[model samples]
Target: METQSMLVVPVGEETEFNVYVSTQWPTLIQEAVAETLDIQSSRVTCHVKRLGGAFGGKVIKTSILASITSVAAWKTNRAVRCVLERGEDMLITGGRHPVLGKYKVGFMTDGRIVAADFHYYANAGCFVDESVLISEKILLHLDNAYNIPNLRGFSVACRTNLPSNTAFRGFGVPQGVLVVENMINDVAMALGCPADQIREINMYTGPSVTHYKFEFSPDNLQRCWEECKLKSEYGIRREAVDQFNQHNRWKKRGISIIPIKYGIAFAEGFLNQAAALVHIYKDGSVLVSHGGTEMGQGIHTKMQQIASRELHIPTTKIYISETSTNTVPNTCPSAASFGTDANGMAVKNACEILYQRLEPIRLKNPTGSWESWVKEAFFEKISLSSTGFYRGHDLYMDWDKMKGQPYSYFTFGVCCSEVELDCLTGDYRTVRTDIVVDIGRSLNPSVDIGQIEGAFTQGLGLYTLEELKYSPTGLLYTRGPSQYKIPAVCDMPLQFNVYLLSDSNNPHAIYSSKGIGEPTLFLGSSIFFAIKDAVAAARSDSGLMGPFTFDSPATPERACLACSSPFIQKIPASQPGSFTAWALDI
Candidate 1:
């Protein structure tokens, strides 16, 4: 499923600008349209019915499209529509930044990480769109669910001759987390210890401070890890995998568990604010408008549920209208997993104000229905409309010192995955996967579970399936789905089970709910490591030992190459016939 970039702008009168588009931030588009037409922001209105699927892709890029289309509409005094074809979209709008991370860590034989030094270089194509912000997030989440005692990490955004890479699902955190996870796996293998043991020894527990100086008072990573181990029968599965590898010659089985502690806020403090407008009619029907755009992530559904709960009404009575700039202005882009934490709070605040207004009327008629109380409040000439706004408090960060609570809170999860790998063809299949997440008293269990599944699948593609090929002239070769592979139904695990943590409550945000957008994403890398485990088993059969490294998108080519064997060693190198490669093959 994909949504191509699109924008529709209709100019009215001289300075009245109107935009209809699929975007996560209408305010950003409105400002762009206004600036393109050289008019005041009040004269511009951006309307967003909804987006098909925008995993932060439309957050910033849509503004440029809307602005370009608005210029045509302004000059011609007509509606202008600009939509990119699938190929054009892929070639013009880039995806996640290709990050190269280098790190060295010191750990004990018990698999505990003592100290680490790291450097990360990101391929920030032609223009630096959000590369700086992405780099910052990479540094912030390098310690994914683990406690790094002594750490020094630096990041660099290298300019490249390619399309500018914007935002994806996990931003740059997954790349950073992958680097650390790979390091831990290497450490575990070097010490001849189980990877899970190393992870557990380094896992955060009790009240502790992060390397960035953030307070991790109620760490739930260990809880999730324990639950995942129990649910997945990890001990039994590990033994089974070992037995299978020992018995099988060509095929081997491997199992791995990964834990995650994702922060739930944007790197920038100002982007952590949200606003909502709520209006209650005399018929008890409520119309709610929030700054967060619905991109099939169930943000609107969650917001509606929040309003309904606050107003003491059924969800059917509350309706979330289309997001518009005229209703709520200056909205932050719906990224960083903070969409629900910030926007839901704004919606709840609006509903709370309306609830207070109707309380007096309801008290007069204790046994009255919601409609009757609403009518009474209307007859009493009480205000039926209110605007509520919320800004994050006490969230700050200094680059020089790198000390402060950059996140409102952390969401934790753990996943255990088992896979069967065919060493000959480098083909693999996930036998079973068990995931445990701490989403803090979920607003909607179904939505949160869907988010976890979707994000994990996307992350799986990033680490094991999706591979982008580009030409030397900065042209993308995999410009469509036919070439670029996203995880399909067949790519899913054969037996998949997801469980949210029980008896968990977060004090931050509304109703003790934490963000579920990007937390489970990095856990998908478990499949890659599991494949690595299988490769190790294959190598051992060939009398090979020690820690070996492999790059991501563990495609068939790389996987087969990593599974060293006498047969692979017997293949002669391609006789070049005095030929040299003409283009980059990454």
Candidate 2:
């Protein structure tokens, strides 16, 4: 509690009180105390710096922290700093929900998936927060890159007293992808087929009308698989691994190729809008603003490219600022990978407006120079200001009906992971990872490549090693860096490769470039499937298990438990008293 929290001070009287420090927001603690209690919301202003590698941890909580700092400044008439310690951040904030999931898939004898049914139960921490949305998205992404005729998915939300689970890099896609990938592996092992043979039968071919009723091309998913397999010599390497595994006992090898067909918009309807402002200055400089948070994912950099392309100006001449609601009113949260797709579409639209205003001037003066045309247009159009909004595709559909193109387009990627596991210890290492993404067009090849690398690595962390742990009292015990482990640099694969399936003239976007953020992150489960294959190889020569469990963060301890026989365990780890409930029946 801050001591300076007072309404008024009389002219004749002296006021004295000690001011205690306030805590930061979204760092784990939900609410914030003012730096000075005397501060009023009306007189307060919030300040925000650049975002670091947030890993999707900053959201609703960050705003509350800013408000607290602003209040502290208002009351004390001095800037008060409240930096959050990692322990407090973790304890107060919700982590990923430990989900109990079941997946069953039926496919043709040739490996073409016919139908899929998935059941996902989420322990939605202490608060509802974003758990329901996550569950919905998992259901939506049941068929990551394959065409399934009949599919059914449902979720039950369980409320726990613990801190509410929130969004992460892969959001809900990884969970969904892993379930289906495991199902595929189960079938392949039963049918005695190589991973590639199964993929070739199931990979998307033509336009598909999904269960949600949108017509999309799944060719990129197959294209990514083809492009990456050829480059990485998947056939040759897989043979090498199989032969090598035959010779080795302690170190066994496994390889698999995965496809990701990620939806590039918010699952919720209300969050499907992005706003942008583009202004061409008098001296040929351009300023652009869009509603995509830059947690170091290159949202600003991408926006600059979009603005430059629209205005026919050099990218260097364009400047983008931090995403602020005040400047770009009624903007959507940058949660969706559509940072470049949605916001970039809006910025591109705004730049088109500015271009229209300047076109007449350019026509009259006949200036071949873009700078000159922009300068003339600015003077003629009364300052060259325009605002644009990305309201999804050109189609019109009822939101409640849930039957329109939710995303402008989909992003595609393929992850081929090779894992070597020690059947004794249940420890595994990613021997190789090959990835290819159809970014439509590469506005910046290096930037797009970096995005793919970062997203895939983050996905690896979620599936291979990162997860949240808590105690029974609904208190989060995995607080701070020590208990909460993420993938380290040394944990990376020995062989990593990336290929972009881009033609530079994407008819869909500013530069025909697609969003690459979450698409690459869903491969966490794909890689895990390969690891599961290795584990199954050691235990049984018969067939893969029905499902490999949501062994995400497939830690050595959990993997060992999954493979090693236990005492007839029937409890669900996500639910409290699940084991007890099972015992009562027994």
lDDT of 2 at 312: 77
Q: Tens digits of per-residue lDDT for model 2 on 1-586?
A: 0111112111112222212212111112112222334432222222223455555556655544554654554466554655566677776655666677787778788778888788988777667777877877776677777777888887766887666777766677777677777777777877778767877787668878866788887766667778888877888988898787678755567788887788776655566667888877777888887777566667788788778777877888998755543466555566667667777788889988888777677778874677677666655655578899888655333435656665567888777888888766778888888887888877678887888887777777778777665555445556666877777887788888888885523466556777777778776555677777676655443233543453566777666656543321344356764553311100
Task: TM-score for candidate 1, please give it.
Answer: 0.97
**TM-score, every prediction:** 0.97, 0.82
Clashing residue pairs in candidate 1 are none
lDDT string for model 1 (1-586, tens) is 4555555555455578678888988888888878777889999888887888888788888888888888887778777778788988888778999999899898876677889988999999889998998998888887877787988889988998888999988889889889999998889889887899888888877888888888876457778888999999999999999999999999988899998888888757899999999999878899999998888899999998999889899999989879998999998988888888899889988888988988899889999999998888888999999998888655777988878788888898999999999999998999999999999999999999999999999888999998888776767888888998888888799999999999998998789988998878888999999999999999999998878978998897888888987889898777865665544544
Give all candidates' CA lDDT scores: 0.87, 0.66
Clashing pairs in 2: 5-37, 27-89, 28-92, 28-93, 126-162, 506-512
On lDDT, the leading prediction is: 1
Model 2 poorest ten-residue lDDT run: 1-10
